[model samples]
Target: MATIATVTVPRRTPRRVYLERATYLGAAIGLAILPNADLTPATLGAHAAIAGAAGLGLARAWRKAQNLDASSLKTSMRALPFLSAAAVDGAALYLPGAGWDALIAGGWGVSMALLAPLSRSGRPLRQAVEVLEAIEEPEPEGEPEGGPEDDADEFTRTIRAMWERAALPGDTRLYKVIRHSPDGLDFTALVKAPDGKPVPELKKRDVAAAFGVHAEAVTIIESTGGPGWAEIAVTPDAWEAERDKPQTDADWWAHNIGREQGAAPGSTRTGKAERPGVVHHFAKMDDPSEPVRINMRKLCTAFGADTDEMRVFVTDRGNEFLVSVFDQPPLADTVHATRELITPNREGFFRAGTAFDGRPVNGRLYLPGGAAHALLLGASGSGKTQLVIVYMAADSLDGATVWGAAATEDAKLRLAGAHVDRLGFGTLYMVRLLRTAVALMDIRGRMGQKVGHDWIPGAPDNAYGRLSLYLDEFNAATKCPRYGQEITQLGERISVQGRKYGIGIKVSGQDGKVDDGQTSTMRNQLRLNGRQITLNVGDVSAVRRAFNGLISAEDMPEPLPQEYGGSTLTLQQIADGAEDPEDAQGIGGIGWVVRGGKPVLMRTLYVDLGGDDREQVLADLFPDTIGRLTDEETTGLGPLLDDWYAPDPDAEEGAGESSTGRRRRGGGTKKAAARDRVKTFLDMMPGADLDLVLNAVAEDGLTEADITAAYNELTSE
Candidate 1:
């Protein structure tokens, strides 16, 4: 093969380049000719032209490099020390000054070198222009209509409506939502079927798949405009197919009960081990025809008690029959459990996840030993105070003894114990001991002491193990110079060791660094060992320290104090001698337990102490008075109790006063007992005179003024 010579083509220069060379050369030549002429014009012109040409080339090169997005351009410009030297050299050639003329020329040269890379690219300017254009142009139309929140809201509404329509009474968990863009939203809900498979007809999953979400997310939920819809989880094909086509009556029937009809009727069937109607018989046990009868007392005694096909009503008729006597009816049966049995409104505390009749469940029933101690941290109006009262009242009616205290006077007096004796060692005995120094001292001394042991200094005898001290505005308590130590001790004892015995404490407060003197102690006793609940007090550092990775610094900004009332974080529980943390699925890991008269997804907002005879108690009891007596007090209650109703003596028998004549009775024992019973029943009604007492019992305090304002605000709207 013949050898081929490869020519390396030189880079091009513009035709106008010669003009630049000529301009610099002419100037140098003219300068040399006008001067004393120690140098020739040719040499001067040549040198000047060389420098000017080089500078022009450098600038061009720099611009080009920058245009191509050369990363090193800026660095190269910054690193050019030689530019300064070149500038000095160029200056010296025109005006000679010792060795400085050479320095001037060198400086001029260096400046040219630095400018070289600038010519490589104009990328920054182009990028800035592109950004401006993008901002000026309108966004492309026909994107997704709603955001994640809108979708979530819609999804929630859908599921909520479906549940309501199905007439399934229980808690409905919004577990998760899986989305496929341009299709629709899909979500999952969990229901409890204690006895068998939950009744499927009670819950329907309707959705739209065109938008990449389930039609149920849109059709069934409450839409507050836009894409606020909740999507329930269901088969995508069914959802998509139904998007354009309307379902006929036959289709609707098939869609609603097809699965049920296909299922085998007995427990012996493989795919139909659980009958839909049998799953939630307990939640509606009151229906007269219930195939089963479960003792409420027995059911409340343990966490998990069998109440399955063990014989419950299979029909809605007002009759009773054993489960063994029951048989599967026709496939199209539409039986509903009656309201008489297992009504959600009955007295009891139910965990969040439990369910009844294919519905999520909530209600509180006292199991004697199910009491829990909690600490709440948040700023004022965070709803922490209300949460504490709600827990206490609900638990108290369930046979729990509640004792509550708060810094404010109104709070203490309102929630004070109705009958300290009724509060005994196991009843809810809310004590308003936040007033005097002695009371503070008494509580402090009793902080770490167990309830069954000897009374601590300042504490009353028989109050041990019988009290659940609810301290509201804990920061105020801890801030008091005289009472702060007691407060600290209280935190230590309750948070670190209070769970073993029946006694418990729920403390609420604002946030700030704990006093250095108490920080370590609080850490070991309160924060480290206690289950911490933070309500929207978004102090990142404080939260990080209090909860570590359970919550991150980023989440703090989202739960600021201004966002209080709705959000709360519960840290792990640390019992004495325990090694591991609780594993609740949510952030705080403490799944919310609702305690109320009905199905509530909220964290047991407030307890209904069933509005018991608050009016009678309010009219009857006063400080230093015989206090409202129960019906049982009338019998064998002698002269010492007489003054209780002295002014109305013979009003009724057995209406007696206390040892001090300062205390008085209402009437004779017989009449008094009757009145007491009536008062108790009345108290169970709404808006009783003992409203303050009820509020305090239910929420540890009765700030009536605040309550009045809240009531007016709610009613006015």
Candidate 2:
């Protein structure tokens, strides 16, 4: 029979063999004392042969394992050599005279058996086997098309999601989302009606309550579970009717006294409290559904602003009041809100609402009561005059009257044509203060072309409502002693008391610097109370002080980098700590802010009345320098030219005409060259007109050289 040998495999390397050697060495003495133990030389020789062969075989197997993968079947096959060596060493214990040898061989066999299994050579194979045994399988499917909701429904869901995401404040609910043409999406929200009245929800009565009455009906329109804002529209016809009716100061007092007596039931109306300029009796417009109510004081305050100067007449329409004055003419757009600033360097600087072209215009602060006096300071060509013209024309359109004296003959003429009722205060006609007062009284008659007697002194009855006593070139006004005194007195009155009487003052200069005594008085009045509209202040101390050091050259608007223009910080802002952005809303020449019990900004529409307005006014004031002319076209080599150049008799009659006509260049010249010269002269004007041409020139891609060549060629004889 083939020998079926029990092979003991070594689990480890020589380190294992060394441990076995130590154990055998220790047992040698013990085994020697045994009766069956043979310590013969031949027995030792056999043990040595087995040990050597075992060691050599194990090394060979290890080398073979290196060539084959330690984790492969080749490594396992190669292990037989080491296992056979360990078995031979173990079998040595049964040989004759092998007592000591048996001990050594047995020790080596046990060590190799234990260590062989612990070796790292088989680790990779074990890991691979374990990995192959672990995995998973798949399961069946669920519904594919998902419960059938159309795309519109899905879109609606999205809108709802967006609405939820907005997460507005607690006391506020998003109202109507008006898709306005100019302003894009506008959120119309109602805040508890501005009166101290409680408004729990949007109702017809709540709208009426804002106007101090009740609405006739209530309506509710819900969205189709879609995402859109909410809106409440209400008409308070009855409340408006009561609010619009006119009432005198006495009538107001009587109404309040009746209320006090009625409140106490048995109380007598003996000594009643003083009332405001106007009063009213209001109740919910006889509508059960309208949620209208009132806070009496709020009604009084809102209407009281315009009631002092005229009778407040209520229109039959909803919440509309017609202010009664000289003749009850229609109100202009400015009467409600100021006109836009025409030649602003900064875009969107003063927009209160978006324009028709979708440009933002809202957030502009309107002057409280629309009655503010402005002090402008700028150099001659700094666009000050143009800005002033826009401002005044805008005011007139808004129902405010303007009366001003120009420092330059050109400006005076321009202003007169724009507002024909302007009183000429040029050098030829230096109207005295008393004369000005008379002119103020005669403004209506002059405008109507009806003759009237001059104003009589000490006649309060003839004094007009409120007048803007504009003294252009304020420095010049101060030079005249009498004018300065009158200005001081007038400023004191207007600064302190004008608002109550509806009078305002506007003082300007080509530059706002003044060293004369009038500076102190004027500055004091302005500081106390007045609006300061500065443009291109140019290191002028007085202008700097007026603006409280906020104005600078670099602050000029973007389009016109080199051009100069900007608004000054408002007075209220300066008074109540000018550091905060809110207070300094008007720091840029764009919008207004309301702060410290005043209209922080007056929504001013800069109305560029066109350069023609300026040119016309200048013609009237300085006909001499500006020259008189009639357009003439003669069929000649060139367009028939008539030179009206002559010495301005007003300046110095014998001064003689300039090299050309009084106008910059004499009339006839090459079409292109003459066009260039005229354009150059016009481009040199200040403000809007000049800016327009400059913009055009840039767009046309014309260079200075091109213009110069054109001028030289055209003017050449």
Cα-based RMSD of the predictions, in order? 28.8, 31.0
Q: Estimate, for each residue in 652-707, the C-alpha lDDT of model 1 and write its tens digit.
A: 44433334311144442433333432342232332323332222222113244444
Per-candidate TM-scores read 0.27, 0.27
Give per-residue CA lDDT, model 2, range 459-555, as digits (tens): 2442233345566676665455323433434444444434433345667675545455234555655534455554444443544443442333322
Best by lDDT: 2
Score candidate 2 by TM-score against the native: 0.27
RMSD to native, candidate 2: 31.0
What is the lDDT for 522 in model 1?
45
